[model samples]
Every structure is written in structure tokens, then in C-alpha cells.
Target chain A: MRTRWIFGTILMLTLVMGCAKKKIETYPAGVSSNQQIGAQTKPYVTNHQEEQTLSSVQEQQGQTVEEQNLQEEKLKQAQQEKEDIRKIIAKRIFFDFDSYELKPEARKILQQKAEILKKHPEIKIVIEGHCDERGTEEYNLALGEKRARAAYEFLILLGVDANRMQIVSYGEEDPLDPRHCEAAWAKNRRDEFKIISSK
Target chain B: MKKFLLFSLIIGLFGVDFGWAKPLRVTIYGPAESKIYVFVAEPINLDGKKNSIMVQEVVQCIKVKLKLFPFFKQLSPKDILEQGKINDVARIDYKKFFLSRADIVITIGERYLPDTGKTRIELRTFDVFKQKMILGKAFDLTNQRQVVLMVRKYLGDLLQLIMGNKAFFVNPIVFVHKGIKKSSIYQIFADGFGLKKLADIQGIVLSPSWSFDGEKIVFSVIQHEQHKLGILDLKTGNMQFKKLPGNSCISPVFTPWGDIAVSLDFSGSPDIYLLDKQLKIEKALVKHWGIDISPCFDQSGSKMVFTSSRLGNPHIFLFNLHNNQVERITYEGNYNTSAVISPDGRLIVFSRLTPEGHRIFVHDLKTGQEKQITFGPGNDEEPFVSSDGYFVVFTSNRSGKYKLYYTTINGDGPYLIPTNNISTFSPSWSWVEEKYF
Candidate 1:
């Protein structure tokens, strides 16, 4: 009786701990929200029935491990993907002064970027066009947009879907390097990509 | 406290006398010849040079006012007095002005009234050619700011008497100067006096346009993470950001009927939209596949001039409101933008990109001839017509960085606006008519 009692207590504690952790497995999002609604609707069950519910919870936990591990693995992969997006995108493409014409080297870089974009069709991006410190601000802003459009069109030509691309121009306002040198201006005059969504 | 309140009330009436709307003509002056070559004498302080600093500051501010006058020129009465020994302030030295090659001799004398303990200013504008004083007035000024501003008011009246046209000698000019983190909008008197920072929107503030009534300003503020459209009311000092139905809104202008014309990317492409006062979209003014930006309303309010890339490159276009017809206005340039019609609604002034760099050009609607006003060294863009339509002010990088330069619409200049050495852009001239109310 003592061995079975200790074993049931341990299993019951593991069931509570596992369910708490599974609630925070870092997003498929539906699990936490569903449990939130469940907590609201039933606030608290009668505490006297804790032993019976604990046994039932242990049975349900044992049965869900196989199925939940697959979902948990998927959630893990999605979390890794979020990190990979944070760590691994070469999203900025630089341009020349007063010219929106993509350079040959820029085109080469975009070719590789285009391939990555094609592989992830679920990702949507916003291309922010920026300019160096030159010209009237309005014209530079328009020029920046033209640079973004040039890049967006080139990506579209390379088979990236048009619906996934968005563009905005910040003119000569937002500089990537913020220095007034040739190399800095070269860096400042470019299109930077931000992933809007993955799902 | 009572003196301060009364003095402030005087300045307040002088300011509200204009209501920050349009300036009113202040001093009454005699009629004069079409040209006034003003010879400004040194201001004399009564009570043994007690208010000499007050007199000197007033004279220098007056010199700045003369710089904007198209016909007026400054002469030194010291040179006239040096030629002939005339040290008298009250005595008439009329021949000294003619000898100094002056058409109008302006002499200012200050006396401290001990009874009131206020500085009483006596300004006399003597017509050298007509051989009589055209404008002479006595002002009891309690403060120096009021004295300087009062002198500027008389100078406006003096210009009207000389040039047969009224000008805003003391009117404010609003322009954008790039600051440490972002560009800020600033207002100064037309003579580059009385600098006041209107807004320090810490990003790129571009293409500032006045409300139809010249009470508020609408500009495009581009920050790193976001872009905004800001409308600042000069009366209340309240700046409200207008939320558009899109990602970015640029190049906001006001129609004569108080409607706002702005360009935004509502459909993922920048297109011109007309918005009501509440910032609700009244209509998509120019819906194009590519970008249609920088829409400026003409004087009649029925037509607009904008830049579009539908022809493969950015070029200025004209849109008529009646028939909703769009027409290409510029045929020469591959990149031409910032088109504003002259106040008279006759000519158009815009900037064109060339191998040398960006230069301002004025195109005649009647003659179809374009004259480039700015040349070489730096790029000049964002030219707008002055309210009088006689001249234009624009931002130019002629000195390696950016500054405001005003020139005649005939391409007569790239005259620096005498501001501090900084990046100044998008100068919109608000020329107020002189009213004597």
C-alpha cells in the first residue's frame, strides 16, 4: 500500500508539472488560449475530488505523450525557425548614389536571397528603401522607393511571389551606417527587408 | 507687472493685429517715387546714450529687412556726414542724402521720456528726390522687442510707398533644418530675424505646406521605424498627426477649399488621395499602377501638378479637376519633380535632374520655354513660388551641404538665405498682403 501510494503521488505531481510546462511550449498559441478559456469557464473544481481527478489526469497524460511529443517537436521546430529568421537573413541590398539600378553584385546577392525566399513561400516581407544624404528629401524618398521597387521587381522576376513583397521609402532619413562617407553613403542607399510573418 | 502686461498687450495687439494670418500695414506714410534708395543714419539715443544698445539693435534689424526689398537699397548717412561736416541730428541735412546717392534718407532718433520712462522712437524717411519726409512716426516703446518689430512695420509701409507694392518685411518664413537626430521645422521673420523652432519632429520632415489659410503646416515625417503625416497649428501650438489609410503618406498639400491632397500607399503603390479635414479619404485622386507623388494645387484650386512614373521615369504631370484629365507637363527631363504653380497661376517652377546635378527650372505655361535658374556645384530641389510669385525659394547643396536659397523666377539667382550653415530644405513662402485695419 505504501509503494503504490508513493508512486501515485509522484505520478500525480508529474502530471501537474507536465501540463503546466506544456501550456508554455512557446507557441502553436492555441493550447494556451484554449486553457485560458477553460480556466475561466470552470474556475476551480471541488478540491475534495483531487485524488480522483489526479488519477484521471495521469491516465490522460500517459495516453497523450506519443501524440503530444510530435506536436511538441513541431513547436520546437517553429521556435527554431523563429530564431533562424532572427539570426540568418541577409536582408539588406545596397545601391549606388542617385541610382536605383541594382548593381551586378547586388543582383548576385539577390539571386541567393531569391532562392531562400522561394523555399519559404509562407514568409511575407517589407522592403524599406533608404537613401544617402543627397538631393531634396522628397525626391530622395521617391528614389528610395524606386530602389525598393527595383529590388522587389527583380525578386518577382526571380519567381518570388508579388503578394509576399511590400516596400516603403524613408528617403535620406534613415541611414544604415549614418556616416557621411562614400562607403557609408553606399551602405545607406539600399533596401532592407523585414519579415512580416512566417505563417 | 502692470508695465509688463501693458507692454505684452501692445506686442500682442501688434501680433494679433496680423493674427499670424497675414500682416497688416502699420504706419501711415506719404506717397513717393517708384524707387526708394534708403540711407539709414545711425540712431541717436537721448539722455546721453542710455538706450544706445536699443537703438543699435533696431538699426541692424532694419538692415536685414532692406535685403529682401527688390527695389530698396541701403545708404550710409555717416558717409554723407563725413563728406560734409553735419553732426546735427535735428537739423535738416537733405543735400547730404542726394550727395550720398540716396533717394530716401532714413534717420532714427530715440529720446527717453522720464515722465513715462519709456523710449520714444522718432523714425523719419525723407525722400531725397522729392526733397521731403515721406514717413515720420513717433512710437513710445516700453520694451526693445516691440521697438524692433515696430520699426519693421514702418519699413513695410515705407516699401509700399517706394515700390507701389506691399511686401512682408516682417513676415515669417517656415523651413526645415536637419538637426542632430532628425530634421526640425523652423520659423523666422522674412528678413531672417526672430528665429523660432516650430516643431522638432525627430526624423525627416519634408515638403512642408501651409494650410489654405496659412495657420497650420502639413509635412511628411519619415522616422526609422515608421512614417507619419503631421499637421501643426501655429495658433494653438498643437501638432496632430493625421492617420491615413495606408502605410506611408508623403507630399501633403492643401486645396483652396481646405481639402488635403496627399500621396500614400493604400494599394501597395504610392498614389495621390484627397482627404477631408478629418483625414478621411475623400477620393483616390490619382490611382496608378506605379508611383504618383507630390501633388500641388494650383492657384485656381481646380488643377494639380504632380510627379508620376507611369512613363517609365519620374516626371511632372498636370491633372485637371473638372474633366479628371491627366496630362504630362514636362517632356525634357527623365526625372523632374516638385512642381508648384506661381501664385498668379501663370508659370510653373520645379527641379530637374541632370548630369551636373539637380537644378531648379521655371517653365512658362504660355510660352513653353524652360529656364534653368540654378547651375553646378550642388543639387537644388524643392522650389516653391513666393506668394507674390516674383521669386522662389528652394533647398540647395551648392555649398556642399544643404541651405535655403531664393531667386527670381527668371533664374536670376541662387542667393543664399543667410541662415546658419546647416541642412535646410523645403522652404514654403507665405506672402501676406498688407492691410491697414
Candidate 2:
């Protein structure tokens, strides 16, 4: 009984080795092998020409993964910079009744805006000046222009390029708040920054 | 006694067709106390019953037009009818009018012609003190809508006989109506009828000024964060916007030579500049460093009055175009603005800001006298002089919401012009020709 089992194991080992040799010869020489022969021969040739093609493909995929990771990092950074710009330009400075002089808080806010503008040299901005409803429409227009010019002059003094900024005055029109109260008036008299271009 | 003889001589010379032949010269000045009493009789319907409503409408319109004359104290028809029945010129008792202290009596007769579908109105004016029929006229109207026009025509002729000055009846006023999201331009007759929306701009409209021919209007509009020059064709209803090279565009006025003069800040400060009809910069008219704005010109365009901050505050300055001379006319107030010259170029009307509120003031150029024409609990601003130089129209918030109000040069009447409930601003009055109506 022992002699019969040993003969059967020897016969199976010989059959597996013969099939592996045939797959290596056929696949390396650009010959199409049957599905059954290719499936049976996959595990045997780790150091053959078939092995070289598999390892080279793995290396190419590894390089692509690294490149994709780098691209995603750059996209995230650009989105973050855009969000920062939006937050900074959204801040508006207030003014007093019939007055265009900048207060202390306004100066501080303008300083921060100047710093951002300095960092982003490609950005262009327009400063809009507005007023409350207490004065005549014509005079208020001149007053609003004075207010916008005040901000423009200040931004110029802060090392920002003069050519990078433009100013406009809306006078007593285009109020930020429509209510006829002190609080609304305070809000209406303001200077708002708008991004004209960023590239 | 002399006044009576002069009146009789004038009436005798001109006869019944006096207003058609030549305008009579009669000058009456100052407030209501010095005004002559005018008695308007209740209108009579010739058909007695069929045309009573039309007659009433005509009489009502006549009364409204009479109120616009500050030199005439209108006696209510009820008060005159209570004295006696005055159905015709022959039935008018001069003794009763004299008893009522009426200096003049006006009788109206309206008859509807059923065949032609028209109404014929006969108007007569009698001098009560002289006891003479001074004027008579007839008007034919095809519809009820012409009642205001007929009244205006009759009053215009009657005014020609009473006062040699031009009448303010057929003239129209353009003003700004402040809405929620935007403001619109509206034109209304001086008699408070025919209110029309000239333009519904998408932004705030300010300082509307009429052209000399009354065919176009120039105004400033705030849109897209800047002030733009807007020209509206009154006849075609077409609007044209021009982007001026400045951060601000303020009050714009049409020069007598048919050009535009506006305030622009292109040279780093607000200054008056002249532009052609196409809105091209012709030249700088008034250039200064201290915020010059609100340019107003006299009838001949020889003199211009504008508000300037050159003297540390806004004050009215008169600029003579002929001599190139600039003189400061207002020295009383720190805040004086929106000054308009009278048609006769003798008086300047403006608004002055006080502790209480803004008030209308008239500065006489000849007499060098400054008189406050408005005493307001709320702000009164944007005073515009009538063509006759007797009436001044302004916007006031005395009735809780800003509306148009008219007073005489002597500040006699503060009658409210019915413009519904919307807040109005910047009334610009112009004398439109009758054909344009």
C-alpha cells in the first residue's frame, strides 16, 4: 500500500512542473496560450519574463499614486487660500454721521486688509463708499467720494500699489441697512472692499 | 382813488378783449394781508340739470387754480352764495361783493352740447371796486379730462389782465419719488393734476433738472456703486446713461445754450463741468478744491449759483459767466445748498439747515436781503422757484412722510401738493409750452 501512494505523488509533481515550463515558453515568445494553461501556470514563474512584466506594472502604479497625492494637496491648498480671501474682503469699516474720517477700529481692519493684499499681489480691489440718509443727495455724493478717497489714500500709504485699487462712491443710496435709526445709519455709512480680479 | 381811476382807464382802453390785445401791468407784492380778495361764484349749468356735474367739476378746478396765485385771497363759493344767488354776470350784485370785501368777482357758465359731444365754458372777471367787466373768454372742451386745461387757460388769461408777469398754470414740475429698492422720476402739473412717472430707474435718482425746451431732463443716478449721468427724453420716454470719469456726479443743470453743466470729481475734487448734449466733457465751468456742486443758472444763463464748501462749509456762490467772476452770496448759514435763481434774476431761493431742521430761504440779489421762507417742524429742503417768481415749491416731511409743498416768495402758503403717500424729493419746476401738454 505505501509503494502505491508514493507512485501517485511522484506522478502529480511531474505533471505540474511540465505545465509550468510550457506556459513560460508560450507567453514569453508572444504566443497566445489557452485559458486553462495560463491559469494553472501563474504561481511558478517568479523570476521569469512574465514576472518582470508584473513587477514593472506595480512600479508604474506606485508612481501614479504618488503623483495623484501631490495633485490633491495642491488643490486643497488653493481652496484654503480662496476661503481666506473671501473672509478678509467681507469685512467692512463704518463711519460716523456726515463724517468720513476713519476711526481707530477702521484703521486696524484696513491694516489687516493691506497685509493680505500685499501677500496676494495679483488681486485687484475696488473700495466702495456709502452714506446715511440725513443729508441732501448731491452733497452726500461728494461726501461719499471723500470717504472712498480716504480709504484709497490709506491703502496706498500701507505699501499697496496704487494701481491695484479703484474707488467708487454710492452716496446716500445703496444703504447697507434700510431702517431709519441710529443703528441702521451707522451701518449705512461704511466702506466696503470688493475683489475685482484675483489672477 | 387813484387805483380805481387807473383800473377804469385801463379797462376802458382795452375793452372786453383786453387780455387778447395786451397784458396789463399790475404789481402786487408781499403776504396774504396785502393780497386782494377774489370771489369765485358757483358755476351755473346752462342746461340746468344735464350739465350740473360738469359745471361743478369746472368750478372745482377753477378754485384749485386760483389757490396757486398767492396775491389773491380766494373767497369760498359757499361764502359768496350765502350772500346771494349769482348765476350770471348780470345777476352778480357788486354791492354784496363789496360788502364781502371782494376786490374781484369771477363767474363761470358751462353748457354741454349734445349734438357735438362737447362742452362750452364761458368765463368772466369783473372788478368789484370799479364795478366793471374787465375780461371775458370762452373755451370748448371735448371731454371731462380737459377741465383742468380749460381752467388753466382761463386763469392764464385772467392773470395776464391782473398781473403782467407770466403765469405758473401750464408749467410742470419734475421730482424724485423715493421707493423701497429704487427711486423714480415723476412729472406733475403745477396745478397738482396729471401726475406721471417719467422714468423708473433701477437706482437712486437725484437732482432732476429740465432742459430749456422742456423736452428732456438731466439727472444723476447712483448705480453699480457709482453715480452716472442720466438723460431722459421727456417726449420719447427713452433713457440714456453716460459713465462720467469721476467718482461722483451731483446736481446737473442745462445751460441756456442747450448744454449740460454738472458736478464731477475727476480732478480729485468736486467741480462744475460743462458737457455737450451727448454727455462729452466740453470744459470745466467751476473748478475748485473744496467740493463745488449744485449748479443753477438764471433764465439767460448769464449768472450761475452753486453750493461750494470752499468757505469751510457749504455756501451758495454766484458765478457770472460773462465776466468770469465768482462771488459768495450766502454768508448767514454754515449749511446752505440747492439755490435756484428766479426767472427775473432778482431773487435766489435755497435751503438752509438749522438746529430744528432745514428751512427754505430766499436771498434777494438786488436788495441783498435774506429771508427764511419756511418754518418747519420737519425738514424742508430742495426749494424750486416758479416761472413767475412768486411761488416756491419744496419737499417737506412735516406730515410724517416727505411730500411736495408750495409757498409764495413771501412764505405765505404752505399748501400740500397731493402726491399720494410716497416720499418725494428734489422738485424741479419748468415752464412747459402749452402744445407739449
Candidate 3:
């Protein structure tokens, strides 16, 4: 009876070890960026006010679980595509307070972004709308959509087919700078680009 | 006990809908502004059904209903006794009341009949100065819930007699409660009792508007994970999800005619679209370059007022349905939105952004005069008016979090609507039509 009990414990330990090993093999250890997307500043804003941009998240040792989880999701989606694919469609556009009209500076950035989409005809992208936490969420959601639609329309004007891009509004949910200062709000009010499919 | 049953039986038979055109809906009557003095005597037969759920439920419903009566100064038995006063039929002194004046005294008695299994309720009222019984009625109710309903309608009639207007009380207010990761819709009584959570949703729920009959609710639940344009049936706990063509959709309002209108980003921009009950896009109501949202149909369902940004800033615009003429309603404020037309269509209440913060304002359409309602610190948004246009409910983050608040048309009391947590938003009051189904 004692020999049988010892044999049972060994079998249970083996099963648990096998599951952990399989999980490690499936998931990448950590997503590393060749460029510091953190230090990139908006060409539209001439001033800086926020203490830190949400992009410098790697330096913050004690991060909130929500922020960490979001990082994981963003990184996992990024890791799925090749390194060259990410570099092409990584640029994003920023907006003024409650304004959807693209600034003169933003137009230059979109000129570059539109040119990349023109080259990668097989790639479909999602234009995500983001907002600062200054207004009620529902209204901000509407504001975010107007921002994304502004970019989407501008891209279409730049000769990109409308069907090549899909739009989604995160409203004030996902902030690039999650703080209460004016600078943070300006940083957060932006539109991000994600490569959905590259066939 | 015998008298209670007879009074209720007579009311249930002949006097229930005396002047109203329909049995389901009642017209709004003018309410007297003078404070009413009412002293409630302890309910009799407390020892008989001391611990019964029937007695408790009936008592609670009565308390909640009484607290909402406008200008009601309810004096409990303990309050009267604390002043060393008894509810004597005669020789009752007006000085005993904390306030100098006393108007009427109300007393309730209840009994159970085993033979017919009917509950009997006795509601009595007396004039303080005349020292005589002004109203006495006995109601034989089939169940405890029926007694509560009968009493509510009975009080409505009494209010009409006293105030010269019969208004609808005892209506429920529905709102969206936002939580940590998710939010859901919840319903609460106007008097802050009977909080019932309808559903626990996975995504953020916004703008829960009640249907005409109060049977189902049409709301937008954004869960890209698991969503609903969600026509939710209240009785059966059933739901039908309608995924309309849009990147994001919000701000759903039901017209008096029952066709659903909502704001959707369909044509690469957020525009108002009228949808059928099944959530099919019937037609695009308004097409604009900038965002067009918060569509509120007038009581006649002929006109609409919504927020638009064609001028570079969001402002309220009025749309005449017949002529297809769009006129800007609010030109004073650079930023104005969330305007709901009063059922009477004579006034409008909306939120405006100012240097102080976002404050509520009431706009008289006829006079073209706008008055600020709230002056507190926190931003107040999404103000809605009750059926009679006497009370306004809005979402305020003044209490450290976003909870519901209510004030009179004149901005009387911006009292906090206490909930379990601060998560209520985009409150819409139920509207009543003159013609009832």
C-alpha cells in the first residue's frame, strides 16, 4: 500500500510539470522593441506638460495590473506580425482638445502613413480612436469616433481605398498618457494604427 | 375590518377611473405649492401579522409612495407622541405640530379575511381645523401587491382633490451603473427604495431608454467581447442582440411613435439613424460631417433636437420633421449638448460647458431664455426631465464619483441620489402620452 501511494504522487507531479513546460513553449518570453516608441513626441504639439507619456511604461517598476494587461495585449498582437511589418504602419496621429480636424503637422505625419498603406495594398489596418479623460465617457466616445473618421476620410482623400481600413473608438478607455494633467490629456487624445491582416 | 373591505370594493368598482379617458394613463394635474401637513397614525393589527412578509411588503410600499408626495410633511406617530400629543378626534391643537400649521391627519388599518382570503385596507383622512372626517375609504384587496397599487391610485385621486392636479407618481427611473471593468443598467424608485439590478453585463452599458408601456428597454451595450443593441424583455429575462453596421453606436432614444433612433458611425462618421424595433436601420435621420448625436424626439414625435459639430463646436440643433428644416436651437453657448424636450414641448433642459464647469440649464423654447440649474464644482452632464417637466434628473460626479441627482424645474434641491456605489449615468425619465393604449 505504501509503495502504491508513492507511485501515485510521482505521476501527479509529472502531469503538472508537463503542463507548465507546454505553456512556456507556446508564449514568447518578452516582446522587445528595436526602436524606442516611448520617446516619440507628437509633431503637432509644440509644448510638453505631462510628467511622463504612457509609452515610457517599461521604466515604471510598479505598474498597475490594468496597464500591464493592456501592454500584454498590445505586445502579443504586435509579436504576431513581422518586425518590418510593424515599422511601416506604426505611426499615429494626435488631436487637439475636442477637435477632430487634422492639424498641419498631423497632415505631414498622415502623408507618411498614407504612403505606407499605398505600398502595402495587401495589408488591412484598424484606425483606433482614443481620447483624454476630461469629459464624460459616452461623449468622449463620440468625440473619438469623429477623430478617427477625420483620419479615415483624410486617408481616403490621399487615394487609399476606404475598404483597406476599419475604424474603432476606444473613447477614453485606453489612454496613451493616463494622468490628470493637461499635458497628459493632450498626449492621450490620439489615433493609433494597427495592422489587422497582411496577406 | 369589514368597513375596510367595503371602501376598497366601491373604489375598485365605480370610482377608480371616474374622469380619466383611459384606465392605464392619467393626465397631469396642477400641483399646489403650499406644504401639506399630514400625520400618519400607526397601522393597526401589528400583533396579528407581526412577522409576515405580506404585511411588511404592503407597509414598505406605502412608505415609499408617501415620501415622494410633493410638499408632503409626514409626521410619524413617534413624532407626534414626542410632542406629547395624541391623535384625539377632537381638541387637537395646531401648536403640537413643529410647524405652526396643520392640514390633515391620515390613519391606516389592515385586516385579513379568511373566508374570501382577501386583505382589507382602511385609509382615513381628517381635517385638523374642522375636526371632522374629510375622506374615509375601505379597500378589499385580493393580494398585498394589489393593495399597494390601489393605495397609489387612491392617493393620486386625493392629490388631485387637494392640489387641483392629478400627476403620475410611483414611476421607476432607469440608469446605467458603471463598475470597475464592466457596467450594467439598473432601476430604482423615485423615492430611493426598491433597487433592483436588472442585469450584470460584460461591457459598458449606455443610455437605457424605456419603451412606451414600460415592458422592455432599448439600450446600447458595447462589449466587442459580447454586445447588444440589446432589446431586453423585462418580464422573461430574454434578449435579442442586433449588430447594426457601425464601428461604434450609442445614445438610443425611443420616439413617442415607437421607432428607435440612435447615433451610429456607419458612413465613416457618427450620424443619427432611425431603427425599427428589431434594430434594422430604417433610414438615416441626419447626415453631417462632424459628430451628430443625442437625438431627442418631441412629445408629438414630429421634431428632433440633437448635438452637432458642423460649426466646429458642439451645439444643440432643432430638426423639424415635416419641412426637413434644421435650425440651431442654442447659439449662446459654444458647447451645449444632451438636450431632452419636455413632454409638453415648451421647455428644454441640457448641459453647457462653462469656465466654472459643466452646469445644467433649462431653456424655455417660447421665451428664448436659458437659466443655469446647477452651480456646484463637479461637472454635471446629461440632464433629463420627468413626465410633467417639474423635476430634472441628471448625472453628477460631485460626490467623488458619478451618481444620479434630481432637482426641481426651478432648481430647488440638487439632492444626491444615493446608490450602493457611484456608477449611475445618462438618466432618462419615462414620458407619458395623452392618448393611452
DockQ of each: 0.22, 0.51, 0.22
Per-residue alpha-carbon lDDT of candidate 3 for residues B1-437, written as tens digits (9 for 90 to 100): 23334444332223333333122122222232456667765565523664345545655666666666546677665565454344343344545543534566665666777888876676665555544445566777775556555666567556655543443444567888777667777876555544677777767777788776666778877676222477777768887667778777777778778878988887767799998866689998898877888888777877788888878788888888888888887888678878888877777888888876688888878888787879867888888887766678888877667788887666656766667774788787666421211
lDDT of 3 at B309: 80
How well does candidate 2 score on lDDT at residue B335?
82
Q: For residue B111, give model 3's deviation from the true position in Å.
A: 7.1
- What's candidate 3's i-RMS value? 2.5
Q: Estimated TM-score per prediction?
A: 0.72, 0.83, 0.70
Maximum-TM-score candidate: 2
Indicate the TM-score of model 1. 0.72
Worst 10 residues of 3 chain A by lDDT: A42-51
Error of 2 at B378 (Å): 2.4
Clashing pairs in 1: none
The regions of model 3 sitting more than 4 angstroms off are A1-81, A84-91, A136-138, A173-179, B1-33, B39-70, B73-99, B108-121, B127-169, B179-182, B225-228, B277-280, B432-437
Candidate 1 residue lDDT tens string, A1-199: 9999999999999999999787565333454676666666655554446777998899899879966998899999988976666444445778877678899988987787688788888888888888987555676776777788888889999999989987778887778786657888878888888888888
Interface RMSD of each: 2.3, 1.5, 2.5
In candidate 3 chain B, where is summed lDDT lowest over 10 consecutive residues? B21-30
lDDT of each: 0.72, 0.80, 0.70
**Residue A107 of model 1: what lDDT?**
90
How do the residues B1-437 of candidate 2 rate in per-residue lDDT, one tens digit apiece? 11111111132323755444222334434323256688878676777755566678887888777776667788765565365457665656788788778888887877776886767787778877667777776776666676666676678767766665444666788899977668899988666777888778888888999887888889988777667899988678788998899778889889888899999998988999999867899999899888899998888889999998887788899999999899999989678888899877789999888877889999888889888989997889889988778779999988878899998888877888888677788999984453355
Error of 1 at B136 (Å): 2.7
Which pairs clash inside model 3?
A: B7-B138, B8-B138, B8-B139, B29-B165, B29-B166, B30-B165
Predicted structure 1: lDDT: 0.72
